[model samples]
Target: MIRSIIKNQECFSIVQGLPEPGQDHNLVWLEVHTPTVEEGTILQQRFGIETAKKNSNVVEDGQFLYMRSRLLALDDNGAPHFGGVTFALGEQLVAIICDDANFQSFDIALQRLRRKPANGQSPKAIMRSLLQIANDRADELVDQIAEELEKRAEDISEISDGYNANGMELGVPDLIETMRALNAKEELIALCIETQLSLARTVRYLSSEIDSTNEADLQGLVNELAFDVAGVKEHAYFEHQKVQYLQKSVTNILNIKQNQIVKVFTIITAVFLPPTLVGTFYGMNFAVMPELSWEHGFVYSMGLTLSAAVLPLIYIKRKGWLR
Candidate 1:
């Protein structure tokens, strides 16, 4: 689908399809979302812009500045997905190309663009707004992931406290689920970081390409956008570090729990080993054994085996290991 936003004086109007060559509106915006074969052909024939490409970058092509960026979107389940977005910036118009899945990602930019004054409605201004929007979204996502990691840290603390205070065990399955969630958040943070960096680079390039004297205000906007997006990238990196810290904390907690369980089992085995040895000696079928001839031999052997087990327990208790 193709939609056009035309600015006439102080008002902006949305129309279907691209603006005519000699149209009334001087400033135009062509949005090609989920374009069909014929629409792509029209874009190629009219604007000479193609969407078939990979990677994110900015380049100058004759009378237009072409930029391809990877935009991040969230699914219904809040999982992050990246899609390609191509922008063709002409003197008075900008054509944005994106897939249907990422079509709504431009809503914020479009809404904010409508609120700008007539002088601020240029293609370069709109491009700056789009980058700024992406940076803002990245900031929000990073903040959210950080909050989640904080909660997960609290959960680890609770599990640790329960285990130390009351011998309550944390289930392996639960630990695994938490780790999986942290891993997913880590992936999301990485995407946010990458997207922010790309946006910042694009803004910096745009600022450099602009004729500073001709459009001083627009250049300033792009430069400020570069700084903002760079800040957001740093924020994402910090959150990524937090994610790693949480992952290590979870691992340590699980390891400690497992070691404690193994320790208890080792103590149990040690306590019972001497009794097993005593029983094995008395049960041997030796007809000439002196203990078999004595009437009280069976009782004495039982007492000795019981004493062997009790002695180990007493020694362990004194060593403070039982606590």
Candidate 2:
């Protein structure tokens, strides 16, 4: 499953093969993309590359250790040039490996390289080119994330306003979920920033040893990465503000609703108090109750009850409480 791209003398070519290491071919690039150590070993055998034997055997700090080495030297401009070998004999690689999201971009670049015949490019040059392409792909991903964030912020703002207008209640769970989503998006933006920063640093390192043509291409890729990082940061800030504002709005709405409930309870109590007092007085069943002996007592009591109820209603109305 190893995919190797070799650019020799301005020509780009790709080779898909198993991993094997011992040949001294100046233009050979070996990449291993196997899921298991056993599979990687088989690939290594097929390619004749030296596999880390004991270096791949032991566990270190509760995890398997994969030993990797790269050559470092000073370039003509006195800048450090790093070119290396990578071995994934460890659990970290296994655990961290994911389905490559950028595989489509890689495939497209490889197809372009294949269509144009390689004149005489070296393997190192080809690797640099591939790295540049990968950096560009990362930038594209960042841009896509930024766009999504912007759209989400807009949608959420609209939803918040609609909820406010409808007098609908948003529960704690809904608010919490919204906050969680915002936090996740913020984390992703941070990750994109980190990724672009790493690529930019690599570009600086590669520019020293890589030829002028590739260097210019890599620099352009670096600039794009920088721009992507900046955009992501800006969008992240906007999203943060939007999320904060929405949360505050929800809090205010909940508070208003609480106050409304209290006011309703108060009005109901005030309206019923007078009727309750009259009912209590009549309920005192004394045999000598003077009102009970009167022929017009029932009408008088009814009038009294009506007056008690109506007076509060009129007063509350005048004070605007009913509104």
Candidate 3:
């Protein structure tokens, strides 16, 4: 799908013709959505873009190579920012590529550009406009991530409190899974920060290379990108702290559990010590055993066994060991 946004157009106007560099030697803005190598080739033939760029666009592995190349080119130019931005030109039109397909802000900006006086707008102005739109979308995404992190943190806090209050035990697997989730969130936050920083640098390069037609909007976008980076950093910090707290909590729970097991074993050993001693004495089978010679000796032995078992249990209870 190829969509063209003329200056001051509010919505993307899809056209059937492939995006080609216009012959007018003026800046034109277009977005191409090609999902296959064939579609990309068609777009390249129509737009007059280099074959390499077209090949880059046709990546079948879904690795986002186009975005990566844009980042790399920006970096090489000393802008080195992450995120998506593309620029192409012909004799009549210059096109800026933005990945945001459904963002309302970009639509509105495109509309306003259409209404702007055409005598003064340049390709650089169009590029800045696109950059601002991309940055605004990124800011929105960062805000959403922040909200999600807050909600997750609240959930984790509640679960932690419940465990503390009820003496609940989490198995090793559950603890490990929770830790893995925290790590994944942290990595995502870092990626967002890197991308935002790269975008900021791209904005800076655009500012230096272009004329002052849309500098205010470009600078505003840079500020917003910086703010987004800060937000991601803060979220990452919070996630790290949560992970540490969870680790400590799990360690403490395991220690308490171990102590309980040790207590049970100690009680068992204390209760059986006397019976073991009595059994050992009666098991002697020598001729010198008086209990074997008398009929009532067996009854005495049974009484002794009963007393041996019950007495230690009573002692342990009196000492509050059973509790």
Candidate 1 lDDT by residue in tens digits, 146-234: 88888888777767665423566656566778889999988888888878877776777678668899988888878777778888888
lDDT of each residue in 1-323, candidate 2, tens digit only: 45654444555455654322432242344454323567556644553343343343222333322223222223344232233333222211111111221223234445544664441233333444444455555445455555665665554554545453456655445545655666765565455445444444444443444455755654454455445545544554555465455546656655655676789999888888999999899999777888888999999999998899899989999999876
Candidate 1 off by > 4 Å: 20-27, 54-56, 74-79, 99-102, 163-169, 289-296
Per-residue error for 140 in candidate 3, Å, reads 3.9
TM-score of each: 0.89, 0.53, 0.55
* Model 3 Cα lDDT, one tens digit per residue, 182-294: 56555655655555556655555544543346466645544554565455546545555655565566556556556767889988887778888999988877779888789
Model 1 has how many clashing residue pairs?
Answer: 0
**Candidate scoring better on TM-score of 2 and 3:** 3
Off by over 4 Å in 2: 5-35, 39-217, 321-323
lDDT of each: 0.77, 0.49, 0.52
The candidate, 1 or 2, that scores higher on lDDT is 1
Steric overlap count per candidate:
0, 12, 14
How many residue pairs of model 2 clash at the backbone? 12
Candidate 3, residue 162: the lDDT equals 41
Q: For model 1, what is the alpha-carbon lDDT of residue 4? A: 81
